[model samples]
Target: MISKKIGLVESIASKSNGLDDIRVKINGEIQRAYNYPKLTGEVNIGDEVVLNTTAVELSLGTGGYHFVISNLNNMESNFTPGGHIMKLRYTPLQVKVDAVEEQESPYHDAIEEFESLENMPVVVGTLHSMLTPFVASYKRNNPSKKLVYIMTDGASLPIYLSKNVDTLKNKKLIDSTITIGNAFGGDYECINIYTALITAKEILKADVVFVSMGPGIAGTGTKYGFTGIEQGPILDAVKKLKGMPVAIPRVSFADQRDRHMGISHHSLTVLNDIVNVEVNIPITTYEDEKLDVVKRQIETKELDKKHHIVYINNKNTEEDLNYFGLSVRSMGRNYQQDKEFFDAASSAAYYLMEVCDDSRRENY
Candidate 1:
């Protein structure tokens, strides 16, 4: 496709009779070389144009000295005599960055905790795209909880866990061998629904599992990630497991965005129709504390329980949220929202492990 950038060299907006006419300069030498007549009254001075000759049409609204041309990559944009110069950039509909640092992470709280744990709990999250860091941490800590990870790409877990065995043992987190598995799939397919069922099973087995992966830059939206999957199978899966499904959204640096709603928060609403487990949804807003209120309501059962949905108000203020790097986007609202959603997912996973630990001990 011929990528094009249109720019307005010059323009003058004027009214003749009842009609409006705009005149401007065109910079594309190709236009003159191709014997194309100059665009008359179509633009004004210092206007910009952007279009791809083979891709999409250039649409400039209102007054501007606009001109269209192909091959923006090879040339620099400049102003014309009658119109303003224009620059063009390419953007994809969806792009995901794993951002796995080759160097060690500067933050070491999780690592330190894992190193100190005698029985490490399994941490679960949606997607296997960019969890190299966590996996590495587990290996380094070598927790006894098997350092198990449930991922969408289930086929690959066995291999990944095996490779990390040495590190896992060295961290002294594992008194025994660690194992990982892919129950459903290995990727982030049907995260909310799949995890609800998986958590149920894990609970029945007396295993603690943590869940993360909310709406975020992780490219796992509700529609394509977890909540969008079929409800019937999800229900069946949870029924087979016979355990409660908790929704805990983490407010973390790895996740924090404004473009999308929290996946865990949304899961509460969506999963209510799918399963019967007790949910731990967190409600976050830009203003007042939302999750704390929800948590109190849940404790009092003041919130409607006619459905299985429950919202846990996080006792975090906006400032606290930002302190954890859970701030919304100053510019890219969508990206920031997505980040928040995913962070919630990770936090939910961590919380689940804690809750499960307590539940298992009580039952034991």
Candidate 2:
């Protein structure tokens, strides 16, 4: 399943945290590649490296970059300290992380002491692209709210693979990050979504939490094949833990694919077949014709019977993104090309903040 080749590092692109983006010459051509210093050690110019070239060979969604499997010149990698929990378990690259729920963790007692989320607002979206608009709008509207991001292993296994995440963190748009399942490289690690949610509230003291996978979502044309289907169970987990769950519908009028036009069939399947609990779904305010299309889908699928569908006015989404200087895209389409897709996220973010505030007032 893996394709490998020997490459010579030609130039250094950039280094941030544990990730190094470099250009390597393979097969007489210079190409982009990524090296995780923690996994393969720091790469240097002129160093020989083993690259996993499968993604590029198959034209997969790896952003046209190969992955450095190992640095031949710097063969030794230092092991990180603490924790018995192993993520990427049983793999050659398996890493031991100090998960927040482990017995040896400093927050272990707090994690065990967890009761309920106490109605902490948890916004759930199926795509990594949803993060930018959601975060920008929510932070713009509620600047003081602590937003913790939980990256699940539905896509990329390493959190460093997402430049969006690094940019958000650098901008302070995201307060903290928690990686769950096999995903790693975050401020904190958790064994699963359950502890990740606990860590977001109980430990990070976040006012709201956003859950999505890292970049590069997997998809197939079939009804049950996309990685975003994880959104269903994620919503269920939020409800089961007594957290308020708000779902960002996958709305797009720009997509040429019929299955993805009004509301993606993937989302339709999740809300219809997978999610077994009540979840709030937010859609952006649109013109009558566009609104009618979404309304017809909701009625046809009986989505309203199972979930709360709220229309939120997210008219300033593009302006909000521009104000924050955050560039976001999905399926290679920018905000202008795919307005509704982005609006869905911004609308959900606004509604989530409102619901959180209303809940707080009721309790007060």
Instruction: Report lDDT (CA) for all predictions.
Output: 0.32, 0.90
Q: Which portions of model 1 show Cα errors greater than 4 Å?
A: 1-142, 153-206, 209-236, 248-259, 262-269, 280-339, 358-364
**Model 2, range 159-186, lDDT digits (tens) per residue?**
9989899999999999999999899999
True-structure Cα RMSD, model 2: 1.4
> What is residue 302's positional error in candidate 1, in angstroms?
9.3
Clashes of 2: 0
- Using TM-score as the measure, the top candidate is 2
lDDT: worst 10-residue window of model 2: 355-364
**Cα lDDT of model 1 by residue, 21-53, tens digit:** 334334544221110112122233454444333
* Candidate 2 clashing pairs, residues 3+ apart or interchain: none
What TM-score quantifies how close candidate 1 is to the native fold?
A: 0.33
The residue-level lDDT of candidate 2 at 120 comes to 87
Best by lDDT: 2
